[model samples]
Target: MAKLENLVQLLDRSLSLHGPRPLFGTKADGRWSWITYAEFGQLVARFRGGLASLGVQRGDRVALISNNRVEWAVAAYACFSMGVAVVPMYEAQLPAEWAFIINDCEASVAIVATPQIYEKCRDLPEKAPSLKHIVCLFEPEGPDGAPGARTTSYGALLAAGEKGPAPAIDPTAADTACLIYTSGTTGNPKGVILSHGNIASNVCAVLDLIPFGSADRSLSFLPWTHSFGHTGELHVMITVGASMALSESVDKIVANLAEVHPTVLMSVPRIFCRIYEGVQKQMTEKPALVQGLFRAGLRAAARQNKGEALGLVERLTLAAADRVIFSKIRDKFGGKLKYAISGGAALSYEVAEFVDALGITVYEGYGLTETSPVVAVNYPGARRLGTVGKPIPGVRVEIDRSETHDSRQGEIVVYGPNVMVGYHKRDEENKAVMMEDGGFRTGDLGYLDEDGYLHVTGRIKEQYKLENGKYVAPSPIEDKLKLSPLINNAMVYGDNRLFNVALIVPEMTALSEWARGEGLTFDSPGAMLRHPRVIARVQAEVDRCSSDAKGFEKIKKVALTDEDFTAENGMLTPTLKLKRRVVLAKYAPVLDALYSGSTKAAPREAAPPG
Candidate 1:
């Protein structure tokens, strides 16, 4: 394929080459539907014309709030072809966040998914004065549940465009294509300004490595609002003329997987973790002989993956297990999954190995939103167990040892065309992450191994994304907990895991007074902390403090300790700041137990503290 100057060019090329090929697959009324590339191209052109009728022009911004749908794709491409930037927000995000993003980006139009969402955002214009139009993908219902009001439906937009087609303006490589908002440590989300060239270069570089083509199909559930899903899955698939089946919802992914028989799956670590857990759960129900065979096969596969010589007996056992056990697991995935691309957060090595042993290659990659979300990835020919593979073409990576105490690893600095122009309008934040030589400081601490594969160690920034790829900034939540007299100190812990848990230290004096008021008795501090009543009380405080937090940011579980982090304990720095690594290391077991359904601070017996 010719070098993609912009995303519009990519769309046009695919239309010319694969006009009759299926481009999008959508599910509705318990049935699957497909739209061809030519049909998609025509829709984009009409949508662009409709947007123009509303006075949307080059350099203007359109805010989109929806889950993955055919209309969402149409709106995005339409905006991109007109040199308009699309600001996409997650449907799962709070309505307040949507308003903030709309105002921040000064969006001229806001396109939402459903009538319910429109109801939530109807008052947004009062808050976001820049927003002039609110277009709903579905028509809004009146008091009797029929089509109502002036809210423009997606179909209406297409009709308007068809009546008076707007010419597609080929955007330059440097024009901003989208603003992807990601959470920061202390404040509201910051918009990462990615240009057309930034994402196009990433897609082209990834296409050169991965073996996706027109025949490949993907069941896409990952939100395109995320850079990984947008550029990596949506854009990359379009470039190669691959079809994508939009998953109905997260709960229906498995059913859709079987129905679509997709050749590719682009997802975060959480999805793979669920698949591994499901397989393990099924194995527990199998006969002893089958379970033994499965375990032996998995062990042999692991050894082989490590390049260890396999005995003839082990090889035979693996082949038998593949036919009897693994094949069924693959069948649940429709037996057509060529490979899965795991990104957004670090995937567990065990999960990757489990999927690989089942004949599905899981190509793990690492990147941040600031770098168009793809720095390095393991592909077909080159893969390592723990490391994200070598940097893609046109990307340069260097380690800044001065940022870390460990000589072998440091902050990863990247320079590439894929790098974003900068965070929108945040010059100070830009200066902090941009290097003197134009390299972007990745904030992640990692190292390149002897073979040039990158091994991610840890993060320098306290902000982290959970296994589900939702970013959480612990300090703000921790600070809120400490505000309660019941909580003397708190540290939220959930990085690359399903949900958030916290380790909290109680105010001993206040706790004792409360215990006395409740007529509770206990011998030691640990015993007092472990009392069910005390645990419930502290949990109440946590609930009260985090009531306003986003759903993902709220603490799901808690572990209590009488031990306070102090300078002497090395959990606190000389400046009285919490040393997160030290705190996590000391309380790792207790915190981990919370996720395993063992509420460590809740006692088995009815013991009271006084």
Candidate 2:
């Protein structure tokens, strides 16, 4: 088995592989860009030298706050070669969050893309007491009103580094490579210190499952702040000598995909699910004959599932529908897409199975940022509709809290080289978590089936108890509710009361437009949410979903959220997972009103505990 001696090896090997071919593709114009592995190497070398000139030495923490630009990738490579630990901050982070992470990571120098990003934490030196410099990655017009304290332009750094003597570098796998801060469910972020080997081992192991070639082209939209995107889309592509086209933004991905025709696609569940929802909405509005055709195609699919022999007529009908209808749907995502992988969140089987039915293979990966993010993935080699496939080679997965069946179940704990070195400088904290022998306990709950394939349930920490002492897992319940195209995101509560309730955030664009189509009047998501007909529609969908869940798990009542639960508002983590505690706290009053019977449910909130 190939092992990662250092995470930076990806940079060395990638720069060496297909040296004459393009490695990074970006826009020189609306639809044009250029790349060559040789040029990539030169850029990385310059950045490294520049950082060195600024007194950034081995083991120094380098903070990078940028949008997804080619320069960001180059900065990572340069830091790796210099053996400087890099910390990626989301450009999407609020000002306070940006400051907190800089201080917590003890970042010495920063590579920022824009002045606004610098201003977000302009006072970092006072707060961190470790910051030495801030270098802007983009062109500046006479400093562009930047803070004058210990800040320099990227151009100057490049010039200085070009003349600076290269520092002797001897990085190893065990040394810390990067500290990725997961926007915590609580107030501050936790810096997950991943070693070079931790990331490198997973990269090499992944090569065992995915075969990448020179012909492969990837269009990336997932942010580099995420581990799944950092390693899976970025490093793995470079490791394999394939070309990558940087996606402009998530909003432009479909158009970008069509232009790039990526051979491999990586995405979140929300993306695929929205695409499916779009197709469904189209079908529902189609002429009766087209609707009939779609139904027939689905019926045919049902009859010939699981490698069953297909009737000739049925096959022909399905084939015809694929060409006429499904082909257009696939074109939206680029017709050349061989397979798409879903990670970072749970994908509904309804969406997964439907995508598979359409001749596009969809695989789901399960992991946390702490696990170098991939513990198990549902690949074609051993994929099932509902399970996140067996642990990848060399990774051990255990789901705790098994119901005495020896089912290999509970919060999934992983033991592998890919596991993190632990949170930075948090010795007691690290000792409390990482097992002596290297196992890291993942708080996510799950179980392994007979085949050893891992299946994630919900977060053990997210579980809540009811007034009667019953506990409920909100994930599955929330997931089921989100399948309603109108419901963008849902959070379930009701651990202590008589039954469960929910705070539903309707997909305002979809819901308002839907209401308009139905002749309902509304100016905002809130107005649309409370319309009698709109409420009835949502309630009906909720009821249908509820019938399937156990009573305790069902959402007996619900309130509408006027705005989105986002990171800036302290309701969601950076990954977009609802912070159960935060959301519960923020929405307590609304939940009270829910229990007070504004939702008009039978189980009203009982009197408060004294």
Candidate 3:
């Protein structure tokens, strides 16, 4: 850790290093607008001026409700410039969600990413009366804009900024810089207070891994509301002076990749997994002999990756396949893609290896929102497939001493400068697990290998045992099940039974096509799940999921579910992580029906392993 005296200084220094370069660039209605290093400096001044004009003083709380966009970054810069703590809530939040966050932060100013979000806050200011200014990034379509009837567009705010002087914010590292809410599965989200030092330090650690500078081009699509998007990509991009593509939507990621050909691409596992699936679907259109050759080549590549010297024939076969088949797949990533930092969740092992084979490096890392979001990562030159690499420079990691686990694994813990100070206003809760020595007990269960790599086995809170008293790690089963094209999602059950069972959801698009080819018909395709053909096919897939497992952990039965497990249904967190407790309660009836040992039922319809 380069002991930073303060974050404001870090920003100043970084700007000096990357000065007036293309700090941000985005398409506005098919036209591109860019802010250079010098322009970026002026904008920071303007944002500060705007905040001051709105009567925001140092240490005042300002809440930001927005989606992922370059404009959000602008607002963040504005808040930090004045040492006024910024609270960021996800755009997916409803009116009530914003109300909770606004009340918790006691914000004096709320910046809505869109007019839509401003509309959501209509009743908040009325109820809380603490909120004052409402800044809008876009004209969101909604019933009413932000509370207090105080709404101003970014353009209007910047104009207001021009009329005021820059606020002199001589802030220290100790000052609270941001408040990011945790995606609560059980209750209202907790405000995680991260000081400027915490975030600045964490981003510096990130820079050590992702080798991009002002010259390197990057695409920003991850939601700024999330730590991974904020700290991992945006912060690192800013520090390095990397040019930002600033995509308009996720649907345009492919086009952006082609248009910008970014050097640094960051995304969750789902994006890559879908790409891999799409590639495979295309290959199915080729002649049988050609397809067989490609498969043979892929197998040979895997063998070569494992360090086995391929026979001349195998090498040639794979080389031919790569040049003709795989090379085109690589082109889709703009043919200049370098670092693909996968986080937010584990990228599928298959997805990781597949990308690696195409000559693009996909580095996997692990962290939580609490630890300023990054504790460990695999740099380009430093990587291992089965592990989330060692602690980043300055972060200290230790397995929890109080962890209760079987001999094979224990809960993971960490300590470092990257750790957030504490949960806002939750001293009692903070005192419970955050140790006096600074260690934070991560609820993830894993054991460090002799090489110091962390391998998370399962969640400590999600553990369940079989009838034989042997524990089952649902994650492994979940990952393995997702490997099957027919299996979109699966939750392994069998807490107290002889063996495990699973609740399965299929990918509707893929499953629907299969149903059509089988001459199946119904009011809705989900009803075709009970057809003998679909049952037999799904049964085969279930068998495949349990094939490599021991009897105790093997899946014996499974029932197909119709609906997708989603955050709206309380079965998933906003991060797309499964809420095991919520899922079980929501689908208790399905579990009971699946285990009832009866074969008669209608498939209402159907859902991936993470």
Candidate 4:
């Protein structure tokens, strides 16, 4: 494999090597549809010409508002080939966020997924002066030929491009390729200016290590607006000539998985967590003998994972469990999922083990959008259960211990070609993160072990100190808590407080089912959560999950809520990371009451572990 100079070269190489191979798949009329690499190349050419027809020239930015779709790829590749920077915004994002990104990037054209989105964004130009044209992926209600008041259908642009095709122009590696806005867990999202070299280098490095070939397929649901999905999945898959079946929606992932039978799975931890919970829930409904056998099989798997010997009985039990229980579970994932790449957040160790035990190799990686999203990842032949794998080729990982208590742990600083140029137009902010030596200070706190695997501890901004001055990294704790089926989402807070506390959102469906089985009656989800028996049960779950945690890391008290931290709720990023500040502010009274011991916040203080 030749080294990629830019994304254009990457695309061209794949097209040349595997032109007739399938590149993308879409579901329509209850079946999966595919587009070959050569056909994808043609779409890129037409999209490039279409962008050109809209007066979108090289160096200009184009805002894309859509989910994972073939057209999204078309527009992105077209921009990359034309030396145009793509500013991708999530469909789940608020209109104001779209306008802000568009204005920030000075996007000349905006391409949306549907007419409904078009209507919402048609008036964006009123606020975003640089946004001169808006194109809809679906045809709008109008005439077929000409543009409509600065808005037009995707069909029109493709037709115009076909009439006057624009030849592919490979941009220099140093040129800007995309402007990915951070999920903005705190303040306004900063646009990370990633160059062609930045993303291309990441894709190349990843492809070199990961053995993804033309035969592999992925059920794509992670938003392309995210760097994890954009560079990790989209560009990497295209470069390797692998096919991606775009999931209809998050709700349709399982259905699409069975239909697509993807060999490779790339997703966030939440999805994996749900799968773990689902499997656990299902097992509870099984016969006692079956449940006992499953538990024994899990013990055998754990022993195997640790290179420990298993007894003949355990081995037989594990084989039977695999054949009876695990095989059925694996079949749900199309029975062909060989590798699952977990990024965007730390995957729970339990979930990772569960999936691996079921036969799918789960590789957990760690990176931020600023590093073109992949600094280190676990692959075959080099994998650790708890730690993210070694840094990719050409990437250097260093830990700055200036602020951390531990000798070997601190901020994870990354120096690599994959590092972004800078945050777009935020020089002061850039200076804060970008080192004079070219390394980007990933605010994430972690340490590279002697084995060279990176263990991400927590976000520096999210980690808080207790009254005793013990630093608590809430992410690991929160991740463990959510592993319990009773807890949907959790945020740990105890900055300058006596001990850590949590705001937990009960997994409503699971909670409701549990309540029904326990013969507990409640008028609402809130009432059920407020029940003493329910609180005691949930606390036990929390305790069980955090059994191995350090003294300061355990949740001393918790306040239950039905409100899930979601993108729409303004308490979570589009990538599903908790907005600590937002969540803390919203639940301040409840959290404060936990310390006071006299408030009506329904904060049940758990007895300290003996």
Choose the strongest candidate by lDDT.
4
Where is model 1 more than 4 Å wrong at Cα? Answer: 142-150, 463-610
Q: Considering lDDT, where higher is better, how would the candidates rank from best to worst? A: 4, 1, 2, 3
C-alpha local distance difference test of each model: 0.84, 0.77, 0.76, 0.86
Best by TM-score: 4
lDDT of 3 by residue, 1-116 (tens): 24454556656777787775776777877777787766777777787888888788888998887776656776787788888898988776656778887888789888876555
lDDT score for candidate 3 against the true structure: 0.76
463-581, model 2: which lDDT tens digit per residue?
Answer: 77888766677887788888887787778877667888788877777767778789888554555666667777777778886677776676777777655677776677766778877
Number of clashes in every candidate structure?
A: 1, 11, 12, 0
- In order of appearance, the predictions have TM-scores of 0.79, 0.93, 0.92, 0.96
Q: Name the lDDT value of residue 108 in candidate 3.
A: 86
- Which residue ranges in model 2 land beyond 4 Å of their true spot? 1-3, 143-149, 165-170, 298-305, 402-408, 509-528, 600-610
- Model 3, which residues run further than 4 Å from truth? 1-6, 29-33, 139-149, 303-311, 599-610
Tell me model 2's lDDT, rounded to 2 decimals.
Answer: 0.77
Q: How good is model 2 by TM-score?
A: 0.93
Ranked by lDDT, the better of candidates 2 and 4 is 4
Span of ten consecutive residues with least summed lDDT in model 4: 601-610
